[model samples]
Target: MPKLPAELRGRGGPDALMAAVGRFSDLMTPLLGLTARGRRPAGPVDRSLQVVVTSVRAEADGVVSVRLADLAGRPLPGWQPGCHLDVHLPSGRVRQYSLCGDPRDRTAYRIAVRLIEDGGGGSREVHALAEGRRLTVSPPRNAFPLAVTARHVFVAGGIGITPILPMVQAAARRGADWHLLYLGRTAAALPFLDELAPHGDRVTVRTDDLGGPPSAALLPDVTGATVHACGPAPLIGLVRDAVRGRALSFHSERFTPAPVVGGRPFEVRLARQNVTVHVPAGRTALDAIRDAVPDVAYSCRQGFCGTCRVRVLGGEPDHRDNALTDDERRSEMMICVSRATGLDLTLDL
Candidate 1:
């Protein structure tokens, strides 16, 4: 942000200043107008932006739906389950929320947010805001994505339900076999149960005290199915243990910084540049590459968006990315969460 002279900040200053500003605006209008008229500039922004709030709905206790309009009244980049958007809230802070409602709605994105007790005023302000408050938001980005597998078992704990909701819906829509295990503290505490019950035998709902531990017995049947679990750390850890031998991918999003994963310093050779990045203890391969070499590009460093997918032209990848499938792991790798299993990793940078 640039600072303005206190005197020149607001007042419709001198007539000269007004004329100059108007002239600048008028001059740029034609350039934009030309592009708008379908005359593309050599370098033009390919993406279109539209600010619109088409509708609002109360889905659960604190969850609400705010419909956004895509450009030219068409759908924007459709997202899979576990996708989120960075919303510039009415409170002027950017908060990310997972898509919670139906995934088939091509016209708009349905996101649900729970009001937090001490969560930095963002969700609270959103709770109080009524329909029709326009806001700027980024395109959807996925942090947890569904893999292409023969079968799947989706597990969600409490509010962690947002991301998996869409995946199960997608599976159900496809008539593909899937089971959803949703656990919350209480029936009332679980917002979407009413909408979830119809899932019949395919859906399991459990609410119990921590001391009474939810059963992990259902996991052995988890064979031949991709196990997708999202929830609090403890629950996720438990699920991970239960699904030990299965081909599974675990993706977790921490609301806050978490202790680093334990790993040793490994060597990674970027074939193109002949650069070797050293993965330090507790550091990921992506971290090593960026810290040791700065020019590499990456985004959605969590490994779900495919933005950081790179080739392991040589050595085996100690795959940790949340999005890679058994097939994908054999090919591209996500440097963000993966580690080098061998002495040296040759990357196709």
Candidate 2:
């Protein structure tokens, strides 16, 4: 099968769409506006940092770690262990990747990319870049920060280790008791094993080939210990189930979008534009709205960033994002990852 054009890939972005329009002018003349909408040049940017790729090396099979530094070689913005960088691709696609390098290395930032053969083109574009390539990136923003605790239980599954690697180092630096449970399909496929090896018994690297899927038995006792997990949904779900009904706090970051419940198509009314668009079961409200008004604000369509937030005039919203507080959800919703709870929704737009 032919690969879909980058413009039509992922949740859709204005820049790539416009770039496509310029190339196939006659065929996509009607979609010229879509290109403008994807750019959203008038929209606000959360972070603006210019950096160049200093190095790119394979950490494991299909996993490449990239180091970015300022052109002037000055200190970039400071970031915590669990913070992530929003890389703006040359194709106008934006992706978020965790910073896995040493936090003390203020001169540059490091991130690892794992090629997802079936994913949107962002990872493939990043993996294709050679050294000396320049890109715009957002200063680090952390939704998953390491909390203060006497002990921490870090669970990382495959590429999810990107963020947890630093947390484990931070835990070690602070002399806090911490245990890392790393899981993968095989030992060679896991990145940063050499770096983690020095930790000795504190880190347990397991693979499906050796044992099996991470079971509740492998999970540590969470009593009085803060549990931080990042991985595929199943592993996070397993940890959540294991630590349920306990006083310990559980923090997790998911690479996938939230599952839609009651996936019936719904109608969305944009109050200011006086337009109503139908959001199909598998599509997001953001996509539907953008189809009508291309300039709608959004960043991190996964709902981590509140850029796409809008007032909910009427209708219950199926809140899927991890960013919003309980109070914020009462009136506002992130249109990117959220959807209408019923047959129709009225938005401030």
Candidate 3:
């Protein structure tokens, strides 16, 4: 029999150790062909739901909205405005897309994707998908939830409008005082304009071509409103700067990973592999660990997916992700965006 990692020998209590053992068994089943007594060897169980592409509509220059429905015409799982789904592509790539359609509609779920020519290939695959194509997707998860406020200020940039659109609709239905400032490079590149038409003057459209690049001064007065912004890092930074020392609450969601504000070089010890890797001050631990363990799972490198999570055997982690709860942080870390506080840290691997 093969030896187990030192941390899994007797530590982590019975439930934790058993969970780790089960994960190990799942990992090893493909390589070892192990099975339960008197049962045939089986592949990993896929708990994701099966959905078929119902429609594909071009919303803008480089953006397209894809509608997904259950295979048997049954109602899909309910979701909120800021929720997103983890879509598994045919090329084995997983990407998270915000739920953009009306939450009251249970017949199907809608997501929009923007083509990135130089990106990691997920968007291109989504664009290539045809109607009737089957897909496996995880249930909707919300890392960004709408706050219950009497007044709201929404700022959306380009494709970032996907999640905010539903929020705007919900706010209007509830008769809340809300406004949206939509920004993009060109009017032709902006999406879902017809949907926002009913709101009239409450929605303001700004294009770089018409009025130069955006600045913090263009934002409306967020005096007593809850401000929600989503966009590129620069736009989010502007929102943060505008809300600093203000009386209102500010929340933001980003398409890119948060930059390492105060990072330092550290050493990571992978106990199972008995290897040590150096993490540079400018690089993430995920990039370094992937050099040794190429099969490490990761998606949405933005630190919101929790797919790159690993068990921490030792050392204190400076958690930077928005996915994990306070309790989960005690024994787990998302290596994609998190780092160690001290000189060295250890992982179960």
**TM-score for candidate 3, residues paired by index:** 0.78
TM-score: which candidate is best?
Answer: 3
Q: What TM-score does each of the candidates earn?
A: 0.59, 0.75, 0.78
Which prediction has the highest lDDT against the true structure?
3
Return the TM-score for candidate 2, rounded to 2 decimals. Answer: 0.75
Ranking by lDDT: 3, 2, 1
Cα displacement (angstroms), candidate 1, residue 150, comes to: 1.6
Q: Considering TM-score, where higher is better, how would the candidates rank from best to worst?
A: 3, 2, 1
Higher-ranked by TM-score: 2 or 3: 3
**Model 2 lDDT tens row, 295-317:** 67665677887768999999999
- Select the stronger candidate by TM-score from 1 and 2: 2
lDDT, residue 110, candidate 2:
95
**Candidate 1 backbone collisions, by pair:** none
- Candidate 1, residues 1-349: lDDT per residue as tens digits? 1222333555654455656675776577666755544474676454434546767767666666566766456767777787887776665555667877666677877666677867556678667766556667677777667886668888888777888888888888888878988887776666677777889988887787542556687453777788888777778778888888764554555333233576767899888888787778787777678765554555445555455678878888888667778987897898877777777788887
- Kindly list the per-residue Cα lDDT of model 3 for residues 221-322, writing each as its tens digit: 888889999899999998888878763798889887777778999999999999999999988898889889876777877777888899999999999998
Task: Indicate the residue-level lDDT of 256 in model 2.
Answer: 68
Where does candidate 3 clash, by residue pair?
none
